[model samples]
Each structure stands twice: as C-alpha cells, then as structure tokens.
Target: MPDLEDLYREIILDHYRNPRNRGELDTPPAVRAEGFNPLCGDEVIIYVRLANGVVDDIKFGGQGCSISQASSSMMSAIVKGRTTDELHRLNRAFKSMMSIEPDPDDPAPVNGNGADIKLGDLEALKGVVKFPVRIKCATLSWHTLIQAVEEAQTTG
Candidate 1:
C-alpha cells in the first residue's frame, strides 16, 4: 500500500490524469461560470444544472494544474447530487480550510466539516500554501465552482 502522502499524491495524480465530469453539460438552462488563476494561468469553466433549488448536475471544462484539476473533479462529484445550499456551504468550508477570508456577501468556499472533502487527498495540496503563486492554481476550480453556483441561483 502506498504511504499516506503517497496515497494522497496518487489521488492527486489520478485526478489530474483522468478528471471527472470534464465535458460540457447539454442542458438548455444550465448556468455557466468561469474562474481564472492569473498567477498560474489556471482556468476553468463550470456548468450547473439547477432544479428545485438544487444542483441537478455539475460539469467543468478547464486547463490547470494537478490541484486545480483534482479539486474540480472532486467538486463535480460532490455537487452533482447536492442542493444549492449544501454546495454553498461546502464551498465555504473549502475556502476556510484554504485560509481564505470569509466575507458574508461574497460567495465563499465551503466551511465546517466539508462533508464531501477527502482530507488526505486534499492534504496533498496543503503544500501549495507554501508557494503563494501555486495557491491560485489550487483554488482555480473552486472559484469556478462558486461562480457556477451563484450563477445557478440567479439564472435558474
């Protein structure tokens, strides 16, 4: 078995090598949002399917680093079956864990337990905080996801 760090590394690499929900969604009423990490040139486009005050499905398209790609994959997986409120909360938790500020009006990454978060796999990205520029790479997808959620609430 791989060591803890190794396992996390593998998780990161696996997500990078083969991302989930990478293509666009075909829904007519889907809301689209975009995120860009100017520091690393990381970018993502998020599509959210809104129905009954929930996110029916989520998808993403982007080019970015391992952290960004992996996070996007994970985000898609978790948000697909979640409500808009749940998604918003999760984003707040994620942003908190990432040490980003929590401004009420501004859309934030999830907070609290981050139910959908796998700590070890995500811990692999902890090293990113050490590199300021790379922080953007790690957060690009999450930023996109937040945009997608916000757009869903407004457009849908």
Candidate 2:
C-alpha cells in the first residue's frame, strides 16, 4: 500500500492530469484575473461570479505543474458560490497556507467577523512548504482567484 505521502502525490497528479472545471465561463458577468509564476512561467486565470453578496460561480484556466494544476482544481472546487467576505477569508487563508504563516487547524481569522477558510484536502499541499521554488506553483490558482475576486468587487 502506498504511504500517505505517496497517496497525496497520486491525488495531486490525478487532479493535474484530468483537471476539474478547466474552461472559460460564458459571457460571464464575472471578472477574470490572470496570474503567472515568473520563475516557472506557470500561468492561471480565475473567473468569479458574484450575485447579491454571494459567489454564483467560479472557474479557472491555466497551464502549469502538478502543484499548480492540482491547486487550481481544488481551488475551483471550493471557491464557487461563496460570499465576497467568505472569498476574502478563503483568499487570506490560502495565502497563510502558502506562506506557512497561519495554523490551518485554526485558519487565519478575518477581521472581526470571525470567518475563516476551512482548509480541507488543501492541507495535503503542506509538503510544498519544503520546496520554496514550488511554492509559487502551488499558489498560482489561489492568488489568481483572489485577484479575480478583487476585480469583481471593484468592477463587477
């Protein structure tokens, strides 16, 4: 039987090889944000839809490594249909995860609202913390999602 780490690697690879939500939205009211990891030339585009204080939809498109692709797939799976505040908290929590700054168990607290991202399978990505260069790859989707949410807030 493969160990947990090996299983995690397979999960990541599976997500990368056959991504979920790998496409563009149709004439979406959503604003798209694109992110690039200059070091690896990895790119990700995040699209978000907000309607009445809640996210109606989310999608992503990009090309990159297992880390980036898997992270993007997971992010898209979680971020859609969340409120703006929820999205912000999720964004912050993801940053904290990549930065290795906040405790995933506790999540990064958001202002005084007491809301936070509930990191799930994403925590498996913690192995990425040991690889600095791979950090950007792991976080491309998250950063792009945040940027897209910001753009939606301002222009959408």
Candidate 3:
C-alpha cells in the first residue's frame, strides 16, 4: 500500500504529465492573466470565461516545474463551473494550506472565512508548504486566476 505522501506525489506527477485544460480560450469572451515566478522562472497563463457570475470554462498554458504545472492543471480542473464566491473560498483555503504556520497535524485547515473548504485533489499540494520557496510555484496559477477573474468581472 502506498503511504499518503506517495499517493500525493503520484497525484501531482499525474497532473503534471497530463495537464487538464491545457490550452487557450478566445480573449473576447475569456479574460486572460499571467503569473511568473522569478526565483524559479516558472510562468503560468490562465484564460477564464465567466458567465452569469460563474466560471463557464478555463484553460492554462505555461512552462515550469512539476509543482507549478500540476498546480495549474489542478486549479483549472476545479475552478471551471464554479461561481466567483466559491473560487474566493477555494483560494483562501488553498492559500491557508500553503501558509507557513499551518498546524502540522491538521490535514484540513480552516480559512480566514472560517470555512473548511474541501480542497479535493488540491490537498496533494499541502506538502509544498514544507518547502517555503516552492509555495510560490504552487500558487502561481491561482494568482493568475485571480487576475483573470478580476478582468472577467470588469470586461465581462
């Protein structure tokens, strides 16, 4: 039987190898944003299509380490069809998971919103907190998603 760490590693690697929603969306209907991590030279571009205050579709393009690419792929998979409110909750939860002071024993930490948002496959990224510098890599797509969402709101 694989240990929890091994399972998580496999999940991450799977997403990295076969990324989900890996492509682009037309900009007129989709808002695009890009995030870059200078320390590791990881770049992520997110294209989000919002309709009726919900994410109708999403896609990603980038080149980076496994962590960044997998994180982007996982995020793209989860965020599509989610409302902006749910996206915010997910962001808070994910960021909390990546926080430096997270309780080591707690597998699911509550976000500032006081909601224990289920991270689903995203839980695989919790181990990233152990490596401080890599947190940015894991979060690059999320930041880009935020920007895309903001632009989507304004231009949508």
Q: Of models 2 and 3, which has the larger TM-score?
A: 3
Cand. 3 TM to true fold:
0.90
Judging by TM-score against the true structure, name the best candidate.
3
| Residue-level lDDT for 146 in candidate 1 | 74
User: Comparing 1 and 3 by lDDT, which wins?
Assistant: 3
TM-score of predicted model 2? 0.83
lDDT of each: 0.73, 0.75, 0.87
Model 2 segments more than 4 A misplaced? 100-117
User: Compared with the true structure, what per-residue lDDT tens digits does model 3 show for residues 1-156?
Assistant: 359999999999999999999999999798889899999999999999999989999999989999999999999898889988888767767887888443344333355633467888899998999899999999999888988898888886
TM-score of each: 0.83, 0.83, 0.90
The alpha-carbon lDDT assigned to residue 48 of candidate 1 equals: 81
lDDT of 1 at 119: 46
